[model samples]
Structures are given as C-alpha cells and as structure tokens.
Target: MTFVKNVPTQPQILAWLNHVKLFEGLTQDALMPIIENANYMDLKQGDMISYEGMPLSSCFLVLSGQVEVYRNTYLGEEKIFGIFSCYDLVAIAAVFMPHNRFPMTIRAKIDCSVLFLEKNSLLLVCKNNPIIMQRLLISFSAKLYELINNIDWLTSSSAEQRLGAYFLSLSSKQGSQFILPISRGQLATKLGMRYETLSRLISSWRKQKIIAIEGNKVMILNVTYLDELTLPSQRAF
Candidate 1:
C-alpha cells in the first residue's frame, strides 16, 4: 500500500465527490470540510485495507479498481461478503456504529486507489448538515435491504439457481457478453459454493451450450435456458 503525499485539490475532490451517491446533491461549500480532511492512497492486490474490529478512524471512497469485504468463518475459511468498485463508499456505516469498528476485513481485490475521509471530520460536517445525515441513512437502509435479500437468496436457492441469478444480474448490467470481473475462485466464494461445485456447474452449462467461457470471459449462448435455471419449477426436469 502507498500513501499519497500530496492531497487532492479541492476541484479534483469535488469532481469525485459529486459522483458519490451519499453526496449527490450537496453543494461545493457543504463538501469543503470532507474534501479538506480526505487523503489518497494506492493499494496493490491482496493488500489488507482494514481488519475486523479495526477502529473506525476513517472511511474509504473507491476511486478505481475493486475491494473485497470478507470474514473468516469459525472453520477458518474466508467468505466474501461483497465487492465495492469505483464511486462506492466503503465502511461509511461503521462510522455511525455504536462500536465504531469494522465488521469485516477489507482488501484490495486488484490494484486500487481510494480517498480516505476522516471520521471526525465527517461527523462534524454531518452534524451541521442534516441533508448529508439523511443521505447517509438512506444509503445504509438500501444496503441493509440488499443484505437481507442476499441472505434469503443464498439460504433458499440451489447452487445452480444461485449461479444463474448471479450471471443474470451481471448480464443486466453488462449485456450477454462481459468478462467476469474477479477470478472464478473469488466468484465461487462470493456465491457461497465450493470451487469444484461451481466449476462442475459451469462445465455442464458449457457442454449444453447454455454459456461459453473463454478464459475469464463468459458469453451467454442460451439466455432462456440460463434464466430457467434460476426458477425452481423449471429445473425439475
């Protein structure tokens, strides 16, 4: 990990802050305190950004690349919780938590850059700016709902169904053909399945011409069949 010695200029900071959902409609004046307190850093792949129970000194704004949020199970295996990409703020909710500590470990999935926004600065700004506080609440609520949905999906859905739903969700954003952003191993962990199970399912899909995989790229050859895999009744046969 490399800490940037020079802080970003106000204009540069404002440009990036404007893209963040939590600061979407805030004016330049309203964002000054945050911009002043933020610093930049670069992380190489596998660099640990924060560990579970780490003090919430600051939160991160992803400027580029991706970060993985994961926790170690009692059995000592890593379970990926989520991936955050550009413009996503990581661990902002932890700032308001009673314990003010990270709940999971965060690491660079690939080489990445992030803006570190100081927690005290953020809280002070939010105290005087109710709009910012409101936006934070909204972002936290949305994330909570997404987490609940994921719990339901992971526990109730079959492995094939889970993979299909994941692929379909990616396809919606990137069309029928797009590179898998992370490695297959990472994908398997994110989907809550063993690596062998995921590989076998993908292999079966390949032979059936449901999807084609070339390296990390996936092309959906049979969109309808792939979609049907996500439906319990349709997969009975």
Candidate 2:
C-alpha cells in the first residue's frame, strides 16, 4: 500500500487503464464499467497501499512513478519482490485468487499515482462484460505462464546466466543500449543478491570485457555469451 501524493483526474485514470498492455484486450466500450466501479486513491511518497497479511480488498493500477513489493525475514532484511513502473498493475495475484491475501508489504519506491478497484466491483464488471471477462481469463492464464518463467530465474541459475538475463530484459525496452529503470537496490532484490555484492559483480563483468557500463547504459559486447550465461543447458526461455 505505498504510493505518491498526486490525485489523478478521470482523464488521467482512463489514460492509465488504456496504457496498460493487459487491458489492451478490452475495447473502449468494454472498459467503461470497470472504470465506473474503480475508485481513485492518492498516497504520499512513503504511504503504504496494502500491508503484508492483509485481506485483498482492491487491485491497484499504476498511473505514474513506481512501487516496491518487499518482505522482511527473520533477520529483518527487506527482500524486494519487485519494482513496478507506470502502466503496470499491482496486486495482480490477489485480484484473481479468492484464497489470497497480500503476501508482502507494498511501498512507494518513489512518488507515484495509482488507482484502486474493489474486488466485488471488479467481479461485477467481469460478469457483466463478456469481452472483459474473456480477456481477463486469457490474461490470467498468460500471467501464470510468465510467473513460472520468473520462478526459473530464482530457483536455479548461474551468476553469468542471471546477469545475462538482466541485460536481455533491459534490451527488450529498445536499442542496443538502454537505461535500467529500477534502482541498484531493487535490481539486487530481483536478482537475489546483496546490493553491494551486485554492484561489485557488475564491475567485475565490465573488467572481464563482457559488457560496457556507462551509468545505466549497458552495452553487451557479446550477445552470444550473454544468452549462454543466462539460459541454462537444458532450458531456454
């Protein structure tokens, strides 16, 4: 339940819902009811939207800025689950799972704008709008598939492979060089490493002539090697 302090106008909320790729399946006509049922909630920079272990009440759609999902373990270290940017949906799992409660604490990684949709209202939208319902089902299925792929990176991997995967994910944005959107600490959370350790590893990769790093720009010197490093022997993602 973290967010920025900006209150969004109706046009802004519509723009956000339209921008999100998952909602692309809905026509302008089809998206109206969901919009009608949705509520616009604003939060300050350090505000929490949903706490760990809370009942899943509303799903959030990011209108601007970023959010971090993290969990604290026995040692009190906060392990980030992920950092989501504009047009991304948060509380995705909770939206579809009746058995689900929020599993982690969500905080604004930076100042952000977000919209909240209550569960029953969301359900009514789906039930009444067949087009949205169909899209939601398909989108949920695709989400599950993507989650399995994400688990692959976490459960098993070599150092080289993880770094390669990181660069590849960045490369998907545009061009041979792109700025990483997330911070070093958030990247460490996704990569399952300490922040300082991840920084050293990136430096080591540069020294090894694997890639050229300038600020957030990482130029892959050898895509072949990077692909080899990130993908496992028996699996290709």
Best by lDDT: 1
In candidate 2 the C-alpha lDDT for residue 55 amounts to 89
- In candidate 2, position 87 carries an lDDT of 76
Per-residue error for 124 in candidate 2, Å, reads 0.6
Please state the error at residue 161 of candidate 2 in Å.
Answer: 1.2
Question: How many pairs in model 1 have backbone atoms within 3 A of each other, for residues 3 or more apart or on separate chains, i.e. clashes?
Answer: 0
Predicted structure 2, TM vs. truth: 0.76
Model 2, runs deviating above 4 Å? 1-33, 183-186, 193-200, 214-217, 231-237
Question: Positional deviation of 59 in candidate 2, in angstroms?
Answer: 0.9
**Every model's TM-score:** 0.89, 0.76
**Global CA lDDT computed for model 1:** 0.87
Q: Candidate 1's error at 27, in angstroms?
A: 3.0
* Top TM-score prediction, candidate number: 1
